[model samples]
Target: MRAFAALLDALAFAPSPAVQVRLMADYLKRAPDFDRGWALAMLAGGFDTACVRPAALHALAAERVDAEFLRLSLDFVGDPVETAALIWPESGTEPCPPPLAEVAPALSSISRQAAPGLLARWFDRSDLPVRRALAQLAAGRRVPGVTPRLARTALAAAFSADLGAIEEAWHGQAPPYGHLFAWLEGRAPHPEAVAGFRPLMPVCPLDETALASLDPACCRVERQWSGMRVQLVAESGLHRLYSGSGDDVSRLFPEIVAAMEGLAGVFDGVLMAACGPDGPPYRPAPPEALARRLGRKTVPRRLVAEVPVFVRLFDMLFDGGEDIRPLPLRERRARLEARIANRTRLDLSPVLAFEAAEAQDAPLVLKPADAPYLPVGPPWRVRKAPPKTVRALLLAARPGGTGERGPDYSVALLRDGAPVAVGDAPCRLESVERDRLDRWVRAHVTGRYGPVRAVEPALVLEVAFETVRPAPRRKAGLALTRPEIVRILWDLPADAADSVDALNAPVSRPPTAGRASRSLPSGSR
Candidate 1:
C-alpha cells in the first residue's frame, strides 16, 4: 500500500513525461507480480472493481467530521475523495495495511453494506498518502498523466521489449496478467495467435499546402464519415470489434460480429449507423444519432433496429492468416474489395477522383495510392480547414486548479433572446488576455454555485469549434465540439453574440447523399 501510494504521488506530481515513465518503470521493476499487475490495470483505467460510491464516502466522512465543514472542504478541494483523505482523523494505530492484491480482491468481492466499515478500518491503518491512494482506488478516479499507452510504454521500457509487440500482446487480457509478466521475465514464451488488438495507424491532418503537391492519380479520396473509427477482427476462430482506442466492443455490436462469421482477417473501417435500414445506397446517420447506440453494455432489440450499423471497409490489415499491412494502399484496397465481396453489413469505402472529391463539402480523407499501412504513423489523413468561429457571451467562470491564476469560462448562446449556457470554452487565452478577463470576472460576479461563479453576462468571446450537433440534454438543446476561445471580443456587446438558431441552421436538415465515386466496385455499391 505504501509503495503504491508513493507511485501515485510521484505520477501526479511529476510534470515531465520522461520522469513519470522512469518512476513507473522503477515501480514495475521492484513491486511484487500481482501488486504490479493490479497497479498497471488501475493506471490504464482497466480496473473496474470499485465497491464504494462517492456519496457513501462523503457520508462516512460526515460521521467523523463536522458535516458543514466537510461540505466546505469538498467545495474548495473540488474532489470528494481528496477532501475525505485530508480531513480524516488519524486513529494513530500502528499502520498495517493489506497488500494491493488482497485489497483489490476484497473491494471486488465485498458487499456494499459491509464496505463502509471495512474502508474505515483500512483508513485507520493508513497514513495520509496511503489513505488518499486507497480513496482514489476505491472511487475509481484516474491519476493525471497516467494512460494505457503510457503504462504500456513504461512496461516496455522496464522489460526492454519492443513497444509495438507489447501493445499487440497486451489486449484482450484481464488483470493480474500472470502470463504476460512471465513472458516478459523470460520464464515463458511469447503468446502467439492470441487474437488481440493491433495498434491503429493514425493520420496527420492534410492542409491545402500539402495537398497542392500531390498528384490526383497517385492518391485516393474517400468521404471522411463522422462515425466511430474501428477495427473488425476475426481470427483464430475469435471475432472481436475494437474501437480506435483498442476497447473490445464486440458485445455492443453483435450484428457486426455475426456479419463477419466466416471471415478471417483484420479490417480497418468506419462503423456507421445507417440513415435507414441496411441496403444499397447506404447513408450515414449524423454523429449525434449514432452516439445513442454507443457505450451501452447491452443493446435493446428495438434500439438496434432503429439505428442499424454497417462497416465501410477502407483498408485490409490482415488477409486470412497473412499480415498484409506492409502492402501498398492499392494492393490492400484490392484485397479488401475481394475479401468482403457479397458480404452483408460490409461495403467498400468508394475511392473518388480528385475532381469528384473537390465537388463535395463534407470533410475528405486522402490517402497515397502507393503508401503502405504503417501502424502508429500512417501518411494519410482528413483534409482540414480552419475551424468555424462564433461570438458567444460568457455566462460563468469556474476557478482554475493549482498554479492557474485565471478561472475557466463558460460561454453561452442566445435562444429566444435569453442567454443559455452552451459549453465551457477552454483556457486558450493569452496570458495578458487571461489576466484581464480574470480581473473582469472577479469584479462582475453575480452569484455562486460552489466553485463556479455566475458572472454578469457582459463579456463576449470568439469561440471556435469544429462541429455542432443536437444535444437534447444541454440547456441550449445543442452541443459544440472542440470549442476553444479564440479571443475575447472586449468591445462587442453580449447581445451581439450569435443565437441558437444560427448554430442550428447547418445541422437542421438531414445529411445529403454524395455522388457515388466511379472507382468503387459495382458489387460494393
Candidate 2:
C-alpha cells in the first residue's frame, strides 16, 4: 500500500513524461508481479468495477460529513479524489489497509449493495494518501500523464528497445502477464503481431488563409460530423470499439457492438446516440450525456433506452487480409461504399461535393483526393476555422508593468441596447492594437480598482475567443476562454455591435457540429 501510494503521488506531480516513465519503471522493477500488474492496470485505466462508484463513496462519506459540504467541496476543487482525501474522517485504527492486489479483487467480487460498507472500512483504516490512491482508482481514471502509449513507452525503456515490437506484443495481453515479463528477460522469443484496435487517424484542422493556394481538382471537401471519433476492430471472433484516445469503449454502446458482430475488420467512424431513425439522418446528442454513459462500469437500462447509440462509418481501414491505410482515401471510399451499404444503425457518412466556387469566406478543407491515411502528421485539412472575430465594447482595462506582468482587458456586449458586462482576461494586443487601447483607456477612464480601470463602454473592439462557458461569477452569466483583443472595430458603432445574447448564445466550435451550426460560419474541411 505504501509503495502504491508513493507511485500515485509521484505520478500526480510528475514534472515531465520522461520522469513519469522513469518513476513507473522503477516501481515496476521493485514490486512483485502480482502488485505491479494491479498498479499497471490502475494507471492505464483498465481497473473498473461497480464496487467503487462515486455515488457509493459519497454515500459512505455522508455518514460522517455534511452532504452539502461534500457537494460544495467537489464543486470548488473540481476533483473528487482531492475532496475525498481532505474531507474523509481521520481514522484511529492502525494504518494497515489490506494489500491492493487483494483489495481490488475483493471489491470486484462484492455486490453494489455492499460497496458502501466496504468503502467505509477502507476509509476508516487508511491515511489520506492511501484513501487518495484508492479514491482515484474507484473514480475510474485520471490523467497521471501515463497513458497506454506511455505505458508501452515505459516497457520499451525497461528493455532498451523501440516501441514497435513492444506495442505489438502488448495487444490482447492480460494483467499479471508472466509471458511478457519472461520475454523481456530473454526467456522467450518475441510475441507475434495480433489484429487488435489501433489508433485512428484524425482529420487535421486547415489553415484558413491559405485556401487560394490549394488546387481545387486535387482535393475533396466533406462535412465534418459531430460525434465521437472511434476505431472498430473485429478480429479473432471478438469485437472492440476503441475511442480516439485508445480507451476501449466497447461496452459503453453494446447496441453498436451487437451490430458489428458479423463484420470483421478495422473501421473508422463516428459514434452518436439518440440521433436519427430516418429524416435528417442523425441529430448528435449533447456531449455531456455521452460522457456520463462512457464513465459508467455498467450503464443503466433506462439510460440506454433513452440514449440509444449508433455509428456512422466513414472509412474502412482493413479489407480481407490487407492493410488499406497505405491506400489512398479515394480508393478506400469505394471499399467502404460496398461493405456498409444499407446497414442498420450503421451507415456511410456522406461525402459532400467539393464546392470550391460557392463561397470564398466559408471555412473549406481541401484534402488531396489521393491522401493516404497516416496516424500522425501528413495534415489533410487546408483551413478548418471560420472567421473568429466578433464585436465587443470595451468596458475595462488593467495597467501594465506590474510585477505580475503587464496589461489586461475586459469587454462587454449590449443587452437591449445597454452595456452588459461579460468576461475578462490578460490583455493580448499587438503593438498597433495596444496603441489604440491606450487611447481608449486614457479617454474613457472613469474609476480604478488597483490595477483594473473601469472605462466608458464606448469603443467597439473586435475580439476573438477559443470557447465559452457559463460564468456563475459574472453578471452576464458567460465567460470566454483564451480571449484576445484582435482589432479595433472603429467602423462598427458601439450600439450596433453584437448583443450580449448573441455573444452569450452557444458559441460554435467551427468544423465540429457545435450547437450554433447554422448561424456560425462553417469551418473549412
Candidate 3:
C-alpha cells in the first residue's frame, strides 16, 4: 500500500517525463507480485470495476460536506478525487490500509450500494494523498497528465526490453501480469502480438510554400474529416474498435462493431455521424454531442439513435490476413475502396484531384504513391488547412493566463446544441460589454478549474484565424492559429452559431475585414 501510494505521489508531482518514468520503473522493481501487477493495471487503463463511480464518491461527499464549500473546493482543486480525499473524515485510528491488490478485489466483489462504505473505510485507514490515489483507483480514472503510452514506455525503459515487443504484448491483457514479468525477466517467451490498434502514421502541417511547387501526380490528396480516427481490428467472428490513442472502445460504439462483423483484416478510418437519412454523407457531430457518446462505455439507446455512426475508410494496412502495408498508399486505397464498398457502415474517404479550390473544405492528405505505410511519426504525409474564420461562442474565461495574449477568455464553437471550447484567447469584450460580463460571470458560472471559469455559453463572437490545422494539442485534433476576436456577435443566436466545418468550407473570394466586424453589446448575444 505504501509503495502504491509512493508511485501515485511520484506520478502526480513529477513534471519531467524522464523523472516520472524513473519513478515508475523504481516502483515496478520493488513492489510485491499482485500489488505491482494492480499498479500496472491502473497504469495501462485495464480496470473498469463495476463497483463505485466518481459520481458515487461525489454524492457521498455531498452528503457530509457543505455543498457550496465543496463546489468551491472542487473549483480550486481541479479534480474530484483530490477534493474527496482532502475532505473525507478519517476513520478513528485505523491501521495502515491493505495493499491495492487486496483492497481493489474487495471493492470489485461488492454491490454498488456497498461500495461507498467499503471505500469510505479504506479512505479512513490512509492519509489524504493515499485516499486521493485510492479514490482514483476506485473510480477507474488515470492520474491526470500521465498517459498509457508513457506507462508502456516506462516498462520498456526499466527492463531494457524491446519497446515494440512490450507494446504488442501489452494489448488485451490484464494485470497480476506474471507472463509479462516473466517475459521481461527472460524466464519466458516473447508474448505474441494481439489483434488490436496500430500506432498512427502521424501527419504534419503542410508547407504552403512547397505545396505550390510540388508535382501533383506524385501525391494523392484526401479530404480530412473532423471525426475520430479509428482502427478496426477483426478476428474470429468478432471486431474491436480502438481510437487513435489505442483505447479499446468496442463497447462505447457497438454500432461500429456490428458494422464490422464478419469482416477480417485491419483497416483505418475516421468515425463520423450521418448527415440525416442521406446517402454517403458522413460528418462529425458537434464536439459535445460526440462527447456524450464517448463518455460512456455502454451508450444509452437514445444517444445511439441520436448519433448514428459510420466509418470513412482511410487506408488498408491488412487485407485477407495478408500484410498490405508494404504496398503503396494509392494501391492500398484502391484495394480498400473495392473491398469495403459494400460493407455496412463503411465508405471510402474521397480521393480528390490536386485542385486548389476545394482543399479548405477537408483534409488534403498528400501521400507519396509508392511510399510504404510507415506506422509512426510525421514527414510521411503533408496536411494543409487553408486560412479561415469561425463564429465561436465566448464560453468561459480564466484569470492570470499563461499564454502571451491569453488568460482572459476561452472560446467554444457550438455543435449539437452544446458549447465546446475551440481555443482560448485574450478577452476582447467591448468596454461596454465588459461591464455586463462581470455581472454575468458572477450569476451564470456553473463551475471552474484553476484559472478557467465556466459560464453559460450564450455569447457569440466572431474569430478570425489563419487555418484550422491539425494539432495534437487540441481536443478536436485541430487548432486555430492567429485567432482574433473580430466581433462580439450579440445579434447571433447561440443555436445559430456557425458550424466548425464552416471554417473549412471553400470561399470564392476573401472576406472584407470591416464589414464582417459587426459587433453588438454583450448583454444580448
Candidate 4:
C-alpha cells in the first residue's frame, strides 16, 4: 500500500503509466506477501489509460515487471475510472468521452472518501493506478482541506521543478513518448527538446564557436543543406511524415511513402531536389521552388518528374530494432547507414573531419555520389564562410489587378558555374489595389516617371539587368536598365566578400618571378 500511495502522489502530480507498472512491480517484489492480484489489475488498467499498453504488455511478456501481480490487479479492479480510461479518445476524434457528469460523481465520491487530505499518501497500496485515479478525482472538485494542497503541488510542478531533471527521470523512472508534450505544456522542461527532431536540430541556431570547441577528434561538420526538413515516424505499420513545423507531409511524397513501406523507426532527414537523367548529382531545390512542391496535396506526374526528391539520410534516432539516440553521432550514423539501404533515394551524409585551427574555409559542397543525403549542407562546400555573388536583372514592372506592384524577375543561383536553385522577388506596393499601386508609385517614385514604387514583399518576379552601380542613398544598388528578365533572387544570405583573407588567415607562398595570373570572367560570371 505504501508503494501504491506514493504512486498515487506521483500520478496525481504527473500522470504516466510507465511509472505505475514499474512502481507496482517494485511493490510486489518488496512485499512478497503483497496484493499481487491488485497490482496486476492496476497495471493493466493504468497501461490502458496511458496508451502505452504495448510497451507495458511487452514488459509483462518479458517478465521484466511482475505478470502475476498485473494479472491479479486487472481482475479485481472494476472501478468506473478503469472503464472510462479504457476508451480515452485520441486527438481528432469526432466526439469526446461521455460527459464528465455521468462519471464525475462516482470518481468524486470515491476519491473524497478514500483520502481526506489533499495529498493522500498511498505508499501502503500495491496498485498505484487506482490511487492515481482517486487523486485526479479528488482534485477535480472542491474537497475540504484538499484543494490547497493540490494547487500547491501544481505550482511546484510549474515553477520549482527542473525540466531537465524530469527528462533524466524518464531514463530512470518515466515513459519516453509523452516527454515532448509534457515539456511543451511546462510539466517538465526538456533541454533536449530539439534533439530528437532531426531537421529542426540541424537548422536550429547553434553557436558555431561552441561546436568548434568540442573535441575535434569526435566533432564533425557538414554543409547546411537547403531543403525541406522531414521527420519520418512509423509504428505498427502506420507511417507519418512531418515537416519541421510539424505539418504532416505523408501524402505529398508518395515516393517516400512507398520507400519507407514496412519500416519502423523515428528518423530525420531531408528530401532533395532531384537531378540528372541517370541521377547526375542531387541538390536541394531552391527554397522558393521547394515551397511550391511542398504546398501541393497531390503533385502532378510531370512536376515530380521535373523535380524528383531523394532522401539524404542523416541521423538515425531509432533502428529497425533498437532506440539508439543515446549513442554518439558516429555510432548513430553507422546504424542509420546500415538500416536504410536504397542508393537511388537514400544517400549517407558527408562528415566534416574536424581540424584544430583558428579558422577554416571549406566550400560546403557534396560529391555527386552523396546526393540526396540526409541533413544536407549547402552544395558548394562546408566552410566557416561561403562565397556570395552579385547579379542584376532587367524586369518588366507592372501592377497586379489588386493594384500592387508585382514581382521583378525570376532568380536562379549559380555556384561554381552550375545552376542551382531559382528565386523570385516581386515589387512591392503598400496598397494592393490597382489605383493604390498608381497612387503609391506616383507619391514615392520621386524620379521623372517614378515608374516603380517599393511595395510589400509579395509577388515574386523574374528580372534581368546589369552591373551594380553603387548608390550611397539606396540600400541595394538599384537596377538601371531593363533587360531579359531572369529569375528573381532577393535577400540572399546577407552578403560578405568571399575573399580568403576575410574568412581565414592568408597563406604566404614564396614569391616567384612569374607574373600573377589574372583573367576577366563574363559580366554574369
Clashes of each: 0, 10, 2, 60
**Model 1 C-alpha lDDT per residue in residues 172-244, reported as the tens digit of each score:** 5678888888889999988653678887778767767777887898899998877899999889898999888
- Top model number, lDDT: 1
Better of 1 and 3 by lDDT: 1
Predicted candidate 2 versus true structure: per-residue lDDT over 247-307, tens digit per residue: 6787788877787767867888878765445522555554444655776667778878777
- Estimate the overall C-alpha local distance difference test score of candidate 3: 0.71
Cα lDDT of model 4 by residue, 1-525, tens digit: 434445445543333333333443354344322233233223322111222223222232223225564455444654323432232222343322222232233332343233332222221221334434433333331112222223222322433453234322222222222443345346765644222223333333333554545454544566556577677766556666666544457787777767677677777777766654343235544434455577565888787677677767666666754766556666677677777765465566666554423244433422222223333342322233322223322112343221122334333323343322232334332223333434534454423323344433222222223222222333232222222332222322212111212112322232232222221232222
Better model by TM-score: candidate 1 vs candidate 4: 1
Q: Pick the candidate with the highest TM-score.
A: 1
Full candidate order by TM-score, most accurate first: 1, 3, 2, 4
Q: What local distance difference test score does each model get?
A: 0.80, 0.68, 0.71, 0.40
The number of clashing residue pairs in model 2 is: 10
TM-score of 1: 0.84
> What TM-score would every model get versus the actual structure?
0.84, 0.64, 0.72, 0.39
Candidate 1, backbone clash total: 0
Better of 2 and 3 by TM-score: 3
Q: How far is candidate 4 from the true structure (C-alpha RMSD, Å)?
A: 21.7
